[model samples]
Structure formats: structure tokens, C-alpha cells
Target: MMSQAAVRQPINVMIVEDDNVTRKYLAAAIQSEPALQLVASFDSVQPALAWLVSTPVDLLLTDLGLPDGSGVDVIRACVGRWPDCGILVITMSSDEDSVLACIEAGAAGYVLKDAGHLDIVRALMDLHSGGSPISPLIARKVLGRMRDAMPASSAPASNADARSLLTRREAAILNLIARGDSYGEVARTLSVSVGTVQTHVKNIYGKLSVHSRGEAVFEAQRRGLLRMATLKAREPG
Candidate 1:
């Protein structure tokens, strides 16, 4: 007998946007996606948080500005209640405070409203599939922010020496990643296979003792291991 193909379950998704038009557009886009299922959509944090308390969702696309509270609260709720669930920010707020707060709260993706419906769907899908899909421009800004947050004090000589544990190729890959290149983009730039990029990234993350891209960037900066590209941004224009 021929083996039956394993069925794939649609990802459960939720939305929390106060704007009627934007919410409808995002909801329709997600609903129409074959791999996504609209578990629940809310206009405020209260209802969304309530729903999350009882229901398990795979992904959450939330706006930073809610009728009741900032969506960071919702992100915190999801991170706290459902650690496995992926969280995404679908808001116009791209400022350092907003982005850093969401990332620190365990959001896996950040999408601005200007990215439009298709990009939003792509980001949701990417985040749900163990990927962190931050826009390149936003990623650049985030890297700059991470570099700027450095303390006035210098790292211990030993700390800097410890960063030398990264291989030359791994260091190069980390710099490209901090510059906002995706795995595919990194592979293209280096003229290597996508799996090669993944391997390098995994090695870099392990060497740096970080679990996410944001953490990798921050840890690089902390250890004085960030490349000249990121280090130069700290210079005044």
C-alpha cells in the first residue's frame, strides 16, 4: 500500500489592531493564506489577552497602539503564557524604544504598516516557521541602536580576547547578519549555498552564546566583537 502523505495543519494566528480598515485588510490576507488560520482578532489588548489565556495560538500579529494599552503588553502576555508561540509587531512604530521593547519581550518579527499586506503575510509566515523576518532598514536601525547603547566603559581585555573564539568565516557571517542580510541574501553575497550560511550563523550564535539574531547583534557589541560596519555607526555623522 502507498503511504499516505502527512497532512499539514494551518498555523493558528491572531490579530490585534484598532484601525478598522487596516485590521480588515490584515485579517483577510491572513485568512486567505492556505497555511494560516485566523484563531481570533481583537481591537484591544484586553480581549486579545483574555482570548490568549484560554486559547493556544501559533502566531500573533499585533499593532503597538491599541485602544486600551500598548501591544507590548500583549506581547509580554503571549511570551509569558505561551512561550512557544511566535509574536510579531505589525505597527507603524519603528522607533528604538518600540522595537527594542518588543524584541526584549520575545517578539520574533517586526513589520511596519508601510510594508503592505503581502510583506505582512510573509513576515507572519516567516516568524511562525522559526524565522525572524526584520526588514533590512529596520535591522540596520536596530544594529545602530544596539551599538549606541554601549556603556562609556570599555570591556575587559579578557572579554575582548574571548570573542576571538569565533572563526574568521563565522565573524564575517556575523557582520553580514548584523547588517540585516537574511540567510538567502547572505548566501548570495558570499557566493555560497544557503545551508552554508545557516551553518555559519548557527556556529556564530553558539560561539556568542545567543539564541536570536537581535541577541547575537547585541552580544557581538557587548563583547567588542562587532565588525567595523557596526562599530563605525557609533561615530558621529
Candidate 2:
């Protein structure tokens, strides 16, 4: 096995941003980063999702809003097909709902498009390295939403407690989520792929009978599990 500190080769990255200027900027940013190799950049989720199935991509930086379909489809495809490939979001929508949807769909990092080239490059690097890179404002928004909805999710569980439903790994992942760590961050911390992290999270959600991260956190807290913060990465109803 490779050492933890060992550096891997340049990550083969794919971009799926829709804007022309943003796409050019993303391509340039990837080209400039020594650790990143641009494999392909597309304007929609359809072609990108199609490309991801057959390609061995190391990283994927996609936008949430595309002309054809939302970027969530792209994230789901990558997570389901190329579990090893790390995924990041670069979008104008920083709403808690949108962020949660991307997270539930299996994105590792969520960064806004307003970020500069260096910021984007850094976020991608962090994500590729197993870190959850989210914008500051977006992070705060998530926290606020969880806090606001805490009352409703505070109800107690029966003999089949929420905590007992999840495995040890799932519990650890929930703790990381409570601490505001992204899927990629949890994966890196556990030395697993982003997809694996999402799988564990999905199992956790299933066991707790929760849909969103915030609901999970609230449910865990109600059942006297790991109590810290809240989040939920699922599509809005």
C-alpha cells in the first residue's frame, strides 16, 4: 500500500460548467495546476455523465445548473460508476437546499462560482486530497437551517433507537457531518473514496429514518447520539 504522505500523479480532472467564460476559466485553472490534468470539459450533464462511465477520471468539478439537466445527475453517475473519482461543485446557487441536494447526490465539495481562479484551484486540490471544501457563507447557511429546524426533528425514537440503527463507521461519518465536514472530507479522514463515504451516509440515513443531513443530526441528537451540528444534501421536495 502507498504511504499516507506519498504524493500521487496529477489528477485527471473533468469540468462540466455551463457558462462559456467560466468553462474557459476552469479549463485554464486546471491546466495551470501542476497536480491537475484536464481530461475533458462539457457544457451539460448528459455528455459529462456519458463520458464519466467509460473514463478513468480522478476528479470532477461540475456546476449544479446546466442547460440540459441539473448537475446532480452528473454527481450521481460519478458516484455510482467511478466511485474513486472525487467530485466537486462549482455553482452560483449556494442555497442550503441546493447544497444539500448535491451532497445527497454524492458531491464531495461545494464551492461557489464567484471564487477566483486560485480559490477554485485550491478547492479542487483540497477535494482531490479528500477534503470537504465549502464556501464560508454556504457553510453558515447550512448551520442556520439545521438550527432553525431543530425543534421539529427533536422528537424521541422508540426501542429501535436511531443510534443503534447505524454501524460504527456510519456513526463516525455522522459525527464528521455534524462537524460540517463534506463527504470528501469524511472520506479522506477515513482513508476511503468519496463514494464509499456517501454509501455509509446513505446507510446512516436509512437506519435513522431521516432524509436530509440536518434531519439526521436532529434525529441523532434526539436519540442522544453525536451532538454537534446539522446538514442535509438532498433534493428539495
Candidate 3:
């Protein structure tokens, strides 16, 4: 008897976009990928919320703007009912408040509508793999907000000791990541393999006691570990 090839399961994806053309485009793009399955799609908030009541999904891709109401409600619902499901926001909104609201409402990833279809797909994949995918521009804004939110009191002297835990290479990798470079892009910039970049990131996460990229960045910023100079925006490739 011949051994059988292992079959991989497709990720179940749900989409909620009020625009008909955009909805179809998103659905088609998702369907084009063999690793993703279009489980359900909604044009507004209510239907998406109603569908979530009985159905379970691996990922929820939603727009912030809806004809009836905000998509944040749907994100919150998924977080409440299906806590394990990863939520990704795809929207045209790049304002600080909108980005912060989605992040506060339990969204794992946020990408602008201007991102290529492949970029959106890659973001979903990253979310599936325990990564938080945030667009470069949105990332800068988030970091800026974090910097501004810092208390007037200086950080403890112990923060420097804690910062020293990261190796030079690890710090370099973290800097690149904070600038919104993907693992692959970081690898290319550092002339290393993607796996190597991921390993360093994993170590950075451990040292920072964070589970995701956003948390790592936030914690690093809080500890005064990041070089603000390196955080200047770079044009996303």
C-alpha cells in the first residue's frame, strides 16, 4: 500500500464590507488562495453579527465603516463569542482614533484598504501564525500614540538592566520590526533567512514577555528600549 499525502485544512474566513465591489473583490481574492475558505460574507454589521451567533470562524476580516453601523461591534461580538478567532480590520481609515479603537476592541491585525490583495492575504496568514500584522503607516501612528501616552515620570533604572537582556542582533531585529518590516523583509535587510528572523523575534517576545508584535513594541517602548530615531517611517515595498 502507498502512503497518503497529508491534507492541510483551509482557514475559515468571514468578511464584512459595506461596499459591494470591494466585498466581491475580497471574497474572490480569498477564494483564490488554496489555504483559505470563504465561510461567509456580509455587507453590514447586523448580518455579520447574526451569522456569528451560530457559526464559528477562524478569521474575521471586516471594514470599520458599514452602512448600518460600525464594524467594531462585530469585532467585539467575535471577541466575546469566539475568543479564539483572529480578527483583522481592512479599512480606508488611517486616523489614530480609528486604529486605536480597533486595537482596543480585540483586533489582532489591521491593514489599510490600499494594501494589495496579497498583502491582506499575507496579513491573515501572519495572524494565523500568532503574529500581529499592522500596516506601516498605522504602525508609526500607533508608536507615536504610545510615546505620547508615556507618563511624565522617568522610567525606573532597572529598565536599562532589563533592556540589556536582548542581544545586539535581537535588538537590531526588533528595530527593523518596529519600523513595520515583515519577517521576510527583515531577513532581506539583515541578509538572513526568514526563519532566523522569526527565531530572533520569538526570543525578543520572550524577553519582553509579550505574545504578539504589537505587545512587544509597546512593552519595548515602555521600557525605553527602542531607538526613536530608527522608527522613522520607511516606504513599504
Candidate 4:
């Protein structure tokens, strides 16, 4: 296992924004960051999706309003081709539906296009570090939606209710993933194969009604299915 103090590699990043100015700004910001390397920049969804087939990037920054198609498609393509890649959406849209759709499609972060270059770069860094950096407005909207989805009269779910949603092993896997462990890291920690971790991930996603790690974590937390303290207590030192 790599020590926490080990030097980290530069994060390879891809950009998919239709607006020329925004795309260039994003590219420049990424290029300026010493820890990040700009791999590919695209002005549309199709080209971005096409390029993803051959090149695997560590992070993807995309805008939702593309001339050819929605950025959600690009997010989905990246998620399918590179499950470990971090996806961040930079867009003007902050509607609940758009935010939920992007989250459901596998985006880990969502920032408004109006963010400064430094802010954008910081968001990318956060996403790469397994933090979901979302615009305040977008975050509020998402939280409001989640709250509305739950029954107003319902009390906090019991541990038994949480356990029923996932097997013990599945919960352990989900806990690790929610804390940002990649499949390989989770496999090594659990003494299982990467393929086995992936199969568990698929089952977790299906049972949680989510398509990505971020969404799975969000849904599980909302459903009161995750006990972070308990999970951490069980982690091997």
C-alpha cells in the first residue's frame, strides 16, 4: 500500500464546454495548476465521448449546455469508460432536476460557470481528492429536493432498516467508497479482486438506485443507511 505521504502524480483532466471562452478559461486554469495536466479539450459532447474511448483521464470538467448534446451524456460516457475518473460539471443551470440528473448520471462535483479560474481549479482539486464541490445554490436545491422526497412524519430510520438495504459486505464496501477509496484500494483492503469489488459496486448502485459513487453515497446518507463512525471503527489500521 502506498503511504499517505507518498508523492502524488499529476491528475490528467479533460474539458468539454461548448463556449469557446469558457472552454479556454478552463483549459488555461487546469494547465496552470502544477498538480493537474490537461489531456484533452472539446467544444461538444460527441467529440468528447469519442476521445474518451481511447484516452483515460483522471478528471473530466464539462458544461451542460453543449451545442451538439447535453453534458450529461459526456458524464455518463466518462463514468462508463473510466469509473475511477472524477467528473465535475460547470454550468449555469442550478435547477433541481438538472442537478439531480447530473448527480444520478455520475458527476462528482458541480460548479457554476461564473466561478473564477481559481475557484474552478480548487473545485477540480477537491473532486480529485474525493470531495464533492458544488455551488451553494445547487447544493441547497439538491438538499431541498432530498428533504422533499422523504416523508415529513417519518422518524430517523433504524439500523435494521439500513442493514436490510445492503448486505454486511456490501455496506463495508460502500463505506470505503464513500470515503474515497478507489476500487483497487478497496480490493486490497478487503483482500478481494478488483472484479469482485466492481460486482459489489454494481449491486450497491442498483440497490441504492444510483449510477455513480457520489450518488450512491448521497442516497445512502439520505436514507440513513450509512454510519460513518461505525464504518471507520471497523477499518483496519
Q: What's the TM-score of every candidate structure?
A: 0.82, 0.64, 0.87, 0.66
> How well does model 3 score by local distance difference test?
0.84
How well is each residue in 122-170 modelled by candidate 1, as lDDT tens digits? 6776566445666555676776676577665765664658677888788
Question: In model 3, which runs have C-alpha deviations exceeding 4 angstroms?
Answer: 1-5, 115-118, 156-159, 233-237
Q: In candidate 2, what residue range of length 10 has the lowest lDDT sum?
A: 228-237
lDDT of each: 0.77, 0.75, 0.84, 0.78
Report the Cα lDDT for candidate 1: 0.77
User: Across residues 67-101, which tens digit of lDDT does each residue of candidate 2 receive?
Assistant: 99999999899989988878888888978889888
Instruction: Indicate whether candidate 3 or candidate 4 has the larger lDDT.
Output: 3
Error of 1 at 214 (Å): 1.7
Superposition error at 37 for model 4 (Å): 0.6
RMSD per prediction, one decimal? 3.6, 7.3, 2.7, 8.6
Ranking by TM-score, best first? Answer: 3, 1, 4, 2
After TM-score superposition, what is the CA distance of residue 61 in candidate 1 from its true location, in Å?
Answer: 1.0
**Model 1: lDDT of residue 9:** 74
Shift in Å, residue 156, candidate 4? 4.9
Better of 2 and 3 by lDDT: 3
